[model samples]
Target: MATHLITGAGSGIGAAVARRLHDRGDELVLVARDAGRARELAERFPGAGTLVADLAEPDRVSWALGHQTVPDRIDSLLHVAGVVDLGRIGELTTKTWHHQLNVNLIAPAELTRLFLPQLRAAKGHVVFVNSGAGLTAHAEWGAYAASKHGLKALADSLRNEEHAAGVRVTSVYPGRTASPMQAKVHSQEGKEYDPARWIDPESVATAILTAIDLPRDAEINDLTVRPGR
Candidate 1:
């Protein structure tokens, strides 16, 4: 069974992907934000490993992981955990920008750096579950979009840097999906939230698994999953 380390396994697309992988008998190392959440995910997956590290506090990730036991062989590192607080450039505070950037970008970079040794050993894959906001900036998405845009740059640079080591990197950009995050976004926009109007989380999970399950001969560099509607 292939071993994978995944963040954001608690809900939304992360939960969907984790369930799919777990049902297939793959080994999972899930990253939870706290001891309580770790216990919750551990019970949910029933044999999956859990690591507790607050992605919102990127600066302390290294010290947090130093005290834990990371998987010795990580076949894939899934950067799925993210945070977003939407606001225009003129209205957004430094705290808002810092929170989004720390969780969505810096934390992933730090996790990837920490796990590179195992990833290189296994010639592994790193998947970044990015957003459509990563591609385009809108009126109220300045800070969040900036972080995601920076994430694209990070993934691109990592792909080039690790190609020689036989490691693969992929960035998945999904349009607004029917997730808790989507509900929050809709509330922020003062709009009605309709789950059916958006792409299913399961569909995004399928897209992710498809890319990672590809043969060693081919690598999917970027995948954009838009809503069919």
Candidate 2:
């Protein structure tokens, strides 16, 4: 089994992906900002490891990626950590915008760079869990959309640069998944979206596994997995 490193593994899509990979016998390094949650998840999975640090903090992110050794050779890097801020242009706060960009774009890019040697050594795959909002702009989702778009660009550029080295990149755009974040968004507006009708986190995680497990000759460059009506 391959060794995989997943960011944002304390919960949601990241946690689901970690569990799936662990169940398939792949070794995992799960990173998240929440230390307690990270420890809980690490405990749940046998042979899994955890790292806790705030991805938005440059020093913390660097320390987290630099100081910690991968449990094994990393064959896949899954970037699942992100932050979303919904507001009209004027409603956006400086902190909110910064947090959105730092967590959603910068941290993942930094982690990818830090792990480049390991990925190159293993000829691994890099997967970015972006959002449909990255491709299409929404009125109140300026910061969130912008950060995701930046992430998409980074993923594509990295794929092109690493293709000759047998390092592949795949960007998965999942729309409105049933997640706690989504619940928070919906609750804030007092509008209930059918959670069951949204895409399942486990399903998205499975798609990531498929992309990584495929032969080197094949690359699932970009994939959009949304809820089917």
Candidate 3:
């Protein structure tokens, strides 16, 4: 069974990914901000380990990863942990922008940098859960769009750097998924967005797992999944 490490495994797309991977009998290392949720997930999968990490706090995140012992070789690294904030240029404060960028962009890149050696050893794949906003910006989504755009660029650059090293990278862009982040955005905007009409988190998880399961010689650099409206 392949071994994978997933960040933000506590809820939404991240939680769904963990559940599906566990069902497939893979060895899982789940990381999240909530210890209780992480523990609850670990209880469902035998041999699964949980690491409570606040990705925004790089020091704590680094200490958590550095102090832990995981499988020497990880077949896949899913950088799914992220936070979203909705605001126009002036409505968003520096703190909110920094917080969103910290979680959505910096954290994943830093984690990948810290774990690149192990991934190289295993010739593993790196999967990034980006957003459609990463490709095209939308109104009232300044910070989120900016952060996701930066994240996409990071993933693209990493894919190029790791191609020769036998490490594959895939960035997934899902448009309006049914996530807590989506709900928050809708609420903040007072928009009548239907969560049920959005892309399913489970389907996105399947896409991620499929990308990792692809033949080592094959590389899917980017994938975009949107609801069939």
Question: Top TM-score: which candidate number?
Answer: 1
Cα lDDT listed for each candidate: 0.95, 0.85, 0.86
Query: TM-score per candidate, in order?
Result: 0.99, 0.94, 0.94
Q: After superposing candidate 3, which stretches have Cα over 4 Å from the reference?
A: none
- In model 1, pairs of residues that clash are none
Residues 1-229, candidate 3, lDDT per residue (tens digit)?
A: 8889998777789889988988878889887676777778778667798777778876567778676665677889999988887878978899999898988998898888888998999999999999999999988888988999999999999988988989999999988888887888788888877878888899899888789889866888999998876
Expressed as tens digits, the lDDT of each residue in 121-163 for candidate 1 is: 9999999999999999999999999999999999999999999
Candidate 1 error regions (>4 Å)? none
Q: Which ten residues in a row have the lowest lDDT in candidate 2?
A: 63-72
Better candidate by lDDT, 1 or 3: 1
Ranking by lDDT: 1, 3, 2
